[model samples]
Target chain A: MNQVIETILQHRSIRKFEDRPLSDEQIRTIVECAQAASTSSFIQAYSIIGVKNKETKRKLAELAGNQSYVEHNGHFFVFCADLHRHEIVGEMENVDLSSALESTEKFMVALIDTALAAQNAVIAAESMGLGVCYIGGLRNNLPEVCELLKVPKRVIPLFGIAVGYPAQNPDKKPRLPFHHVYHEETYQQDRSELENQLKQYNETISSYYKNRTNGERQDTWTRQMANMLSKQVRMYMKEFVESKGFNLK
Target chain B: MNQVIETILQHRSIRKFEDRPLSDEQIRTIVECAQAASTSSFIQAYSIIGVKNKETKRKLAELAGNQSYVEHNGHFFVFCADLHRHEIVGEMENVDLSSALESTEKFMVALIDTALAAQNAVIAAESMGLGVCYIGGLRNNLPEVCELLKVPKRVIPLFGIAVGYPAQNPDKKPRLPFHHVYHEETYQQDRSELENQLKQYNETISSYYKNRTNGERQDTWTRQMANMLSKQVRMYMKEFVESKGFNLK
Candidate 1:
């Protein structure tokens, strides 16, 4: 494989970091790489908040369920799905965009745009020999996160990226079998066939966990998913998003 | 910049593709790169559908508002936000995950996961000297598209990517001002300050359009946004997603 593909395939989430920060040039280049990603209709409905303040990082780390990596990375960037700017465009052009901006279609555009940019940022960081981890725990307390970040209406903070010099090189987690995640022309709907593939994958994952933890834990992917999904998470997300002036339609 | 970052920074949507198709190995490598992207809580809540059937592509092209690129690309892959597999995991574990699966939080996770993977695939294709375009026009008739693809419940066809050797190299569209999109510590909610930056960007974009189209289209970004958002597009999206057994909570 080529270097770019190699960088992508060698990816692993880095939770530990060295005691150093990225230079302003490095950060700018990373964001510039992000800006080059395709936006839905050039709406560019996203923003990156670079958290350099120690106090703010500390509070954010706490908000993200005490992830020390969130507080101690070379840089922490909060990627938000933002339509507040488009709202401004509506105002500047003397047009009403309330019906469109509040639609779920536009909401999906913002989310997808934010994610595409964030992934580009991740790849750029990795290519620069930096390590990164995505912090979905930011959703642990979305309203509080919005309050802490002073985010305005029509902007939802989706996730954060912790970028730094690597302090730990974790094993790359095995993904679903290639056949399981890919289909040809149409979706494969044979449950028995899919379950058989998952069954084999379950064995691989069980072995992975066993080896990773020195036999202390041997768990299947399905079991892990079941344990997590049996309980509702961020149950207020729908109402919270609506309250934040999104998806009100 | 490294080769990977260089590839990323040079990204532009390629709507015109040479008449060609990606080899099976090439397609596999692209999907592998996509699977390597970080997933929320390791959920990996997405799937890729590779369309090779001429009739299917032709129909999809029609469904996507007759975007010829969607029909004639070397390959068209539909990226989906998928919880159907998770629903299966729930069944095997004999646990009810309906509440969790249908939550808006889970919906966001699926969307984000799908987009991240799709972006990686884009980068991978670009690194291999191929060109790509994101076909958000697939959303024009999502219900019919889903039926055509035989998509199941809890799976959303978010968008399509058209990949191929480039037939044309378009100039990169300039993005919004860096300072306007990247904030420090907290979100800058000062509307006037934001508008001033956008006004400047409007000039840049206006010049770009004029230069690109030989003065045929000298439109500003805000004006374009105002024009698009004024018409309510895809207003059925919210009801459709709910009908697909997602975000029912």
Candidate 2:
């Protein structure tokens, strides 16, 4: 395997970080790499906010489900799906872009663009021998995050990512088997074959977690899904998205 | 700048690919890298189908608005927002996961997961000196693609990525100024500063495109947005998504 391929295959989310600040030059390079990612129709419908202030990081940590590592991570960035830039351009050109801003298509494009850019930043960070973890918990307090970030209308916070040198190396989590994921020329609903594969995956994941974190089996992947579903974790997202000026209609 | 940062800063889309085949080892490595990307709550709600058959590639090319590169790219992969795997798992455990599969949250998670993973694959490919281009045009004929690929319910084709050695070295496209994208502490609708920056960007993009394409002055980025909005490009997306079993209700 290629050296880069080996590096990629060994990737694991690093939640613990060394106590060192990223250089300004490194920050600039990573952000520039993010900006280099392709945007749909060149709208560049995303923005990233680098949070360097300690007080601000503490507040974001609270907002993102009290994740302590977020406060200590050497570099923290919030990626936003933004149409505000285009709206401003429209205003200057004396054209109406309200339809474009409100459309679901536009919202999807912005979200995808943000994800692409953020992923580029992650790869760049990793290549520089840095560790990174994405904090989807940021969405847990969407409204508050929006207020703190002073996000304008037509922009929504998608996720936060923390990047720095590693303090710990977590075990790589198991994925479902290839057959469960890679369908050939059509969608298959053959539950029997999938169940057979997933049973093995459940054991694989359960054992991996057990070995990594002592002998505490916190249920299988299925149980985790059920727990999340029963809790209705994402129930507020629709309202939150609307509040952020995205008209899902 | 670090070598990785340099690679990222110099990134450009390579639409034209050389007629070369990626080794099976390369394919496995890239896919494994993609699978390593973070998934929402570890649901891993995505999949990829590696397309190698020339006849299938021709049909996919037709589906993707006749992009000939789809047929010629050394490796073509379709990234999918997949919930069918979970649905099958549920069926085997005789567990009711219909609500999970039907939720808007699940659909968004799947889409985001797919994008993140695909981006990882792209980065891994680039690290190995391979070129990549994303084909958003895959959505143009969603139903046809679903039919052709035999994509099951709860598995929507998010996008296609064609990867291979570069046949053309396109210039890195300029992005909006940093200030236009990076908000400080909050969202501000301040346009005067951004508009000033955009004027320069417009000139840069115009000149770049003109020089690249035989004196044909394409409209500025702002004008491109205007032109796109005037059309009904995303007309079928809503219905297509609904048919894929996402209940946005």
Candidate 3:
């Protein structure tokens, strides 16, 4: 594989960092790389909030299930799915984006566009030997997150990334089998060997957790997912999303 | 800048392709790189369907607003935001994921995870001297497209990517300026300097479109957004999402 592919395939989420801050130049280049990602219909439809204030990070850390790395890292950024910029820019040009701004399609567009950009930033940070972790737990307290960030209507934080020099190297997590994730021509409903393949996968994951050095949870993939997905983990997110002015009707 | 960062920063949507199909090994590598992308809570909530049959491609091309590159390209893959695999596995483990299967949060997670994976695939393709274009037009007729792909419930096709060798090198499109995109500490609402910056940016984009070798159009960024965002594009997507058994509610 080529260098770019190598960098991407070696990807892992970093939750620990050394005692160093990212230079302003590094953050600028990362943001530039983010803007370089493709946007749907040139809408861009996203924004990045860089967090460095000690007090704010502390509160944010508490809100995000107390992920201290969100405050302890070299640099932290909240990637938000934003449509307010388009609204403001449209108003300036004597047009209104109210119709487009209110659709579920545009809502998903903003979220997807932000994700595409953030993934680029993640890859860019990784290429520079910087480690990053995505903090989806930020949504644990969405209203507080919005209040803390001063995020306006039609904008929501999808996730946060903590970037810095690596203080810990986590194992590269295994994924579902290739055949399970990829299909040719169309979807496959009946695979005769899937049961056998999954049995092997369960054993592999069982061993992975068993062999871990820290906080080992001896559980296979299915058991973990069964526990996590058995119920609506974050049901309040629906109401919270609408309360943020997204018409996710 | 390193080669990976350079490659990512210089990305452009390639809609035209040369007369060459990807080798099976190349396709396998691309999908492996995709599987390597980060997933939320190890959900790995996505699947990819590779389409190569000319007739299916022709139908998909029409479904995706007649984007002929989707058919003419050497390889085409539909990236679906899926939870079906998880659902099936849960059934095997005797844990029904009924509640998780219908949450707005999980819905968004699936979409974001799929996009993250697809972006990795894009980078990997670029790293290997390939080209790609994400086809959002597939949502134009979601039900029909899903029918064509045999996509089951809890699996929505987010977008499609057409990959192959480049037949035409499209210019990398310009984006909103760095300051407009990246905010420090928190959101910067002060617009004392934004108007002036936008004016300069408008000129930059005007020249970019005006000087294009193909279908030159003299338009500014704000003006273009104003025109496009005035109406509700893809208004039917909300109902279609619901029809596919995704409670995006």
Candidate 4:
């Protein structure tokens, strides 16, 4: 197998990191890889802010539910879903952007572009022998983060990436059996196969949580999904996107 | 730099293809690489439908702005942002899922997870010397696309990926300069710098479009942005997502 394929298959999320700082060159290389990722229609609807100041990181840590990793990582970057740059390009080119900025498809494009670019950054960091953790908790409080980061209109902080040397190796978590998400020709909602696979996965995941080298927890994949996904998490995002100059209408 | 990073830096959107089909082993390996990508909280919130049926691909081609590449590619996959499987788990576990499924955070998680997984698939394809193009036009007619793919509620087809052996090599489209997207410590709003940089990149891209071996055209990057993004693109997406049982609320 190729090195690129190998790097992709052996993926892990690193939360606990060694206390060190990433050199300027390393950060530059990572950001370059992020820029090289594909963009929809070449709009490049994304921006990343590197956060190194201790005070800012500390405040960001608080906003992200006080995850110490946010404050202690070697380097942290806020990946933003951005359309402001495109709007400015439109203004300079004298194009009327009213209808475009108001559509949900445009908003989805920005979100998808940001995610695709950030994933590339993740692979790049991993290939460099660095550990990375995606901080989705950055969305816990959106406005506060935007204010702290000075993110302008038509931009939303989707997630943060904390990069550092690995202080610990987390066991590779198991995924659902392949057939669960893969289908031939069309979507086959074989609930029975899914239910059966998930039931076994619940047991496997529970055992992993219980026996892992870190904080042992008692929960199955099923219990976690039911507990985490059924609740109103970030109920304000609908209005938040609208308020950030993104028309959800 | 490593071969993996080098591969990432050379990404190009492939629309033309040689008339051939992928081996079963190549398709299996691509799916495995996609599954191996990182997910938020291990929530692999995505499903992929492989479309080899000529009739289905033709219908998709019409729905996606009549891009013949959709039908002509060696392989095409509909990458879906899905939480339907998670809800099934919740039902089996007797967990109240309304709160989770009804939140905007949940929706964003699915979107991000799906994009991350798809990017891995793209890299995997490119590593195998196969060319791929992302069909964002999948969003052009979401309802019809959904009906064609037998997609259910809480499962949205985000984009389609067309993959094949390269029939033509297009120039790598340029991205905004690294400094334009990367900021130190905070978000920078430097319109003058951005405008200046884009003006130069615009010339570079215009020449690319005009002199490319196939379908030579005249359009600067800024002009294209103004022309393409200025109009109402995929205006039905807001209602479509909601109708599909996604809570943008």
Name the top TM-score candidate.
1
Interface RMSD of each: 0.6, 2.3, 1.5, 1.3
Give the higher-TM-score candidate: 2 or 3. 3
Off by over 4 Å in 4: A213-216, B210-216
Q: Model 1: per-residue lDDT, tens digit, A59-92? A: 9999999999999989999999999999999999
Let me know the DockQ for model 3: 0.76
Q: For all the predictions, what are the DockQ values?
A: 0.93, 0.54, 0.76, 0.78
Task: Please tell me which model should have the higher lDDT, number 1 or number 2.
Answer: 1
> Quick one: ranking by TM-score, best first?
1, 3, 4, 2
lDDT tens readout by residue for model 4, B105-163: 77788889999989999999999999999999889888898899899899999999999
- Go through the candidates in order and give each one's C-alpha lDDT: 0.95, 0.79, 0.86, 0.87
Tens-digit lDDT track of model 2 for B53-127 = 899889999988998889898888898888877776665556777776776567667767888888878877887
User: What fraction of the native alpha-carbon contacts across the interface, defined at 8 angstroms, is recovered by model 3?
Assistant: 0.82
Q: Compose the digit string of candidate 2's lDDT tens values, residues A157-220.
A: 8889999999997777887776666655454556666777788888877888788778876567
lDDT at A175 for candidate 2?
Answer: 77
User: Which model, 1 or 3, shows the larger lDDT?
Assistant: 1
lDDT of 1 by residue, B150-176 (tens): 999999999999999999989999999
User: B79-113, model 3: which lDDT tens digit per residue?
Assistant: 99988877777877998787777778888888889
Better of 1 and 4 by lDDT: 1
